[model samples]
Target: MPEPAWRNEGTEPDYRFTLANERTFLAWIRTALALLAGGVLLHQFATELDPRIVVTVLSAGLGVVAAVLSVVSYTRWRANEIAIRQGRPLPFSWVLPALAAVCLLTSAVLVVLLLIA
Candidate 1:
């Protein structure tokens, strides 16, 4: 029989790790959807009829970042799961911090725009 991709030569596969990775991917997807919803809300309800340039820029930037993060997170999670199964060191955990920074910066920009406009 062909060996499972996650199974190593002698060690038992870690199903828990695999499941956790899957969960992480789902969470990223949720985050992306939330960002998209927020952008839609800003475009539809929050912004003025014409919409400020900053508002449109920030919303579009956030939506793009979230979508990119979703793809990156899923790919990284799969790679990490495969690495763990193969007894290799996992990749760095940078996505969360990057996402957080994007959110913070975007919020700051929005606040500044609101105050000025």
Candidate 2:
């Protein structure tokens, strides 16, 4: 029988690692969907607010960030999987910090808009 791609010579396959990566990707996608939904709600339901500008800006920003993160998440997962298969160290340092910063910025913007609205 041919060895599974996730298994290396003389070692059991790491299904845990593959499953964890899949879970992380799904989490990112779910987060992106939530952000998109929030944007849609803000644009459609918050029409009576005094500061439409802030709401609109925040919603648009969140949607764009979510979309970007979704793409980044998928790309990162693929890269990490490839690296693991090839016995190379995973590339995670850059993506982690960037994603954190994006979330922080989005939260701060949302807070500011809420305070002012």
Candidate 3:
């Protein structure tokens, strides 16, 4: 992985593009960190929901999303780097839609839990 970053396989892309890709990957990592924090806070502080499992499930969901994004973001970054080097089209990812769906579903569940509480 480290070697790939330094490899000069294809055309050397601009430092700006590589920097931008690094920033994007950092952003995703930051998002995952925030999600993990939110999950911890909810699990530790929001203790009134009935069935008790609601909070647990919600926290777990956020954790899972965070973990997934942490992994997939690397893959996305690598793909973008490869595309830039090869001068090929970058791959479109489904992560955005999938993330939105996960968040929306989690929000709905939270709303229901709040109502029930």
Candidate 4:
């Protein structure tokens, strides 16, 4: 693949920082995969969850989140790389709070489902 133009614009960052960024990117990817797996497992093995449609929607939501996260992870990594190379403060992102909110909402829904079941 052709190298990105932005990569050529800035001095190379320290190897340790670059590797750390890569690791963070990988962690995001792993989280996305875990969410996807949870969704599939919920749909396939959660036969007892009430309201089949709710379960289906929740399962699908997880898949969607996973897909979004996959893309977001790459973009965030690129942004961080660029910032690092340019000697700028790392760019702020909403991913953490957003992820926390999603987890909280998912858990609350599951709790409600369990109570109802």
lDDT of 1 by residue, 1-117 (tens): 996565554354578877887898888888998988888777666565333766787778878987897889778877777777678888888888988998899888777766766
Candidate 2 local Cα displacement, residue 97, angstroms: 3.1
Q: 78-100 in candidate 2: lDDT tens per residue?
A: 77676666667788547667767
In model 3, the runs with Cα more than 4 Å from the true position are none
lDDT of 2: 0.76
Cα lDDT, model 1, residue 1:
96
Error of 1 at 24 (Å): 1.0
Best by lDDT: 4
- How does model 1 score by TM-score? 0.81
Clashes of each: 0, 0, 0, 0
- Between candidates 1 and 4, name the one with more favorable TM-score: 4
Please, what's the RMSD in Å of model 2?
4.4
**CA shift of 16, model 3, Å:** 0.6
* Candidate 1: segments with Cα more than 4 A from true spot: 1-12, 49-51
Point to the candidate with the largest TM-score. Answer: 4
Q: Name the candidate, 2 or 3, with the larger lDDT value.
A: 3
Report the lDDT tens digits of candidate 3 across residue range 1-117: 366553577988999999999999999999889989989988999888877887898898899999999999999999999999999998999999998898899889889988877
Query: What ranking of all candidate models by lDDT puts the best one first?
Result: 4, 3, 1, 2
